[model samples]
Target: MGDRATLFPVKHVIALDVGGTGMKAALVRADGTLLHEDRRATGRERGPEAVVAGILDFADELRVLGERRFGEPALAAGVGVPGVIDEARGVAVFAANLGWRDVPLRALLSARLAGVPVALGHDVRTGGLAEGRIGAGQGTDRFLYLALGTGIAGAIGVGGRIDPGAHGSAGEIGHVVVRPGGPPCGCGQSGCLERLASASAVGQSWATACGDPSADAAACARAVEAGDPRARAVWAEAVAALADGLVTGITLLDPRMLIIGGGLAEAGDTLFTPLRAAVSERITFQHLPDIVPAALGDTAGCLGAGLLAWDLLSTEVSA
Candidate 1:
């Protein structure tokens, strides 16, 4: 390691993206370069309190690392977590996947980081912010970021900002019922888009069909690529449901683009080709936005968190 001291201070911020099982963090410079990056398991199995503590511990470690490397503490910090968030209060309202509820994440992080300002955001929306600002939707004024992961979610982006609706759940396109009498969703709705279209759903469907309970969406995509008829049928169903749900979003938002991300999107053309055709066929009066894959992959969340921290500092300075 280099010397722990430096002659001049380098401006940077700490960024953390917390998922159900993992956390990605970075020390980001003002010009968007990731000066340092790290990852760790969320230790969710240890329970929600432990998860929060782990985040705090991780942030502390990053802070110490940054001070050691750059000779300055992070000016501010930002974190993105999965769940229903009360952004105004910086509270994690509910996160079924992480077993979190009403966690004062911003305050906790700020206190842990010796009062460094903290900005907290929802994970998918935060990722969408990065996608719209610097990734696939870059240069587009309006776009919809759809992540087809373990669950499906949408982030409505406009003018380089994510619209966190009135109740803080604006772009929940996944819960939009596409097939009224279809499979049940964890969100307490039957036939929701995620139930039929998410990566997890696709994998479960494929597993049932192929008689392999351990199979996943990537395996299903591989099978489809190999011309497996059963896999093709399964892929087609998920695409159709996704298209239907997207059409509904298009009808409402009329975004300039649709940026698809998450594990299913890893299939590339296997997911996009038929998806585009199906969406085109279903849309009658709605304009079909250009569909593209997410450019940042898994790093979007951490980048977005950095942006969030930068934005917070900007706001503070402006005020």
Candidate 2:
């Protein structure tokens, strides 16, 4: 036995996305291979402190699980979360949904996880990176990966890198005010793209139109399938708002492809059908990028964070 440590691969990374309801974690190889995966409830209702503890526990569990299955400790951890992040500073400035403020999550995780290099990124931007590098945007230099779910956000990819901008708040397309005075958003803004085009908006708008407070987007879609005129109208508004946002993006970035992901993208043709039409209607002379659904679904963020960790490792090894 020359050197037992030399037998193992040079790098491994844990990708974790801490959400309000739960956390998604996966052990990934340098080449973006999935070595293992684990999920656990966020326990956020118990408060922010408890949520952090739960994440630490879950991460520890994964470290043990990955080591048992693959025979090595994780090299690094990439934690993705929603909020106003100062990526360069490795801090979560504010996360409204999580009630996180001025939280040095990277430092916290780093201290807890034994000085393993920890990278923290915005959840949506990280997903965008994954899409741009390995999934639908594998070959594209310029692309926009948009996530339309409970909220709306995007990843702006240029020259094969996701640019999170100076404030790490670059791709907040959802907060772009479309209507001067429309529905209120969780961000405390009115007429945001989120209020107009998000999955919640589609369902809520439909329910309100139909004079039923209980109906959600899924039920509204069902109503649409049953030919409910009001449901159709609500869905149309969402499609139109999304298209408007897309048009703005195209005008600014001129990306060659637009990747749509998240829960609403699951609608398949129901989304693409009218979305394409609306986008086409807005563009007069410019060429429209191919709008396609994201290939990796929700796992894009996990895979992307792993990719970032791999990148960090490679950079260090070569240096």
Candidate 3:
């Protein structure tokens, strides 16, 4: 009994990462270790109200689990949501994936959790926060974290903080024009970085070139490795566009590191080797930042939410 009691965490926080399709959540100890973790569908097809209700219910379940296991409720909670977020105001300004607009997420979660301090954050920014503090970018003062999944997005970190910018949309690097007059983006921009280099973009390009609708980026990478000329061309084009956008980012941000993650990054050296060479060739006088893969994988956002909750707890104690 004594041993079991001693194993229980003295304090904890709730962390939730809400995405378009699903949510990842955790109960984390003060020292940044997860005590419990869970995943649930977002059910966005049911509408935005249902998604909000789902988040609240999931959070409540986590809190109850924490109390039962640790003998107390969590000290604080943090949520990371996609799209334009007003972290300062705790509002989800707009999220097309979940169809949220001007949702007072933090306040609602706080109330649901019985006044527990709640912190709201942008999803990519929160994930970058985790990568910078405890993952690949740990100990680095400046870095850019890029996720290249179905779409592309970025998080800029400076001095151990994720810059939210004036409007909380500072790191929308995907929208940067890379190949003007090229393919159109959902954002209404033609030849945006994401449209040219994201995983979905690569898949579309490969499918078109190979005349196989089911072909994807990973298959393209495998074909490249196998010395297929068409696959190589497709891969090279995506890499070139990505390098162009990255060069622009490097010139502007001058980060010490560039951490790449997401489904596309799974190509490992097939992506990094060519990407490094391309970025290097484009650099004129800029100091080259170390390009690396993200260490936390899919859990970065949830862990980052934990960090936010911990930060909130610290801020309250100081106050």
Q: Which stretches of candidate 2 lie over 4 Å from their true place?
A: 1-11
Clashing pairs in 3: none
**Candidate 2 positional error at 192, Å:** 0.8
Indicate the TM-score of model 2: 0.93
Best by TM-score: 1
Report the CA-based lDDT of candidate 3 relative to the real structure: 0.93
TM-score-wise, the better of 1 and 2 is 1
In model 3, which runs have C-alpha deviations exceeding 4 angstroms? 1-9
| Rank order (by TM-score, best first) | 1, 3, 2
Who is ahead in lDDT, 1 or 2?
1
Q: Write the per-residue lDDT of candidate 3 for residues 55-133, one digit (tens) a residue.
A: 9999999988887778788999999999999899999999988998999999999999999999999988899999999
In the predicted model 1, the residue pairs found to clash are none
lDDT of 1 by residue, 1-319 (tens): 4646567777999999999989999999877789888999999999999999999999999999889888889999999999899899999999998998999999999999999999999899999999999899999999999989999998999999999999889889999999998887788889999999999999999999999999999999999999999999999999999999999999999999999999999999999999999999999988889999999999999999999999999999999
Q: What is the C-alpha RMSD of each candidate to the true structure, in Å?
A: 1.1, 3.2, 1.9
Task: Point out where model 1 deviates above 4 Å.
Answer: 1-7
Top of the candidates by lDDT: 1
Model 3: how far is 275 from its true place, Å? 0.3
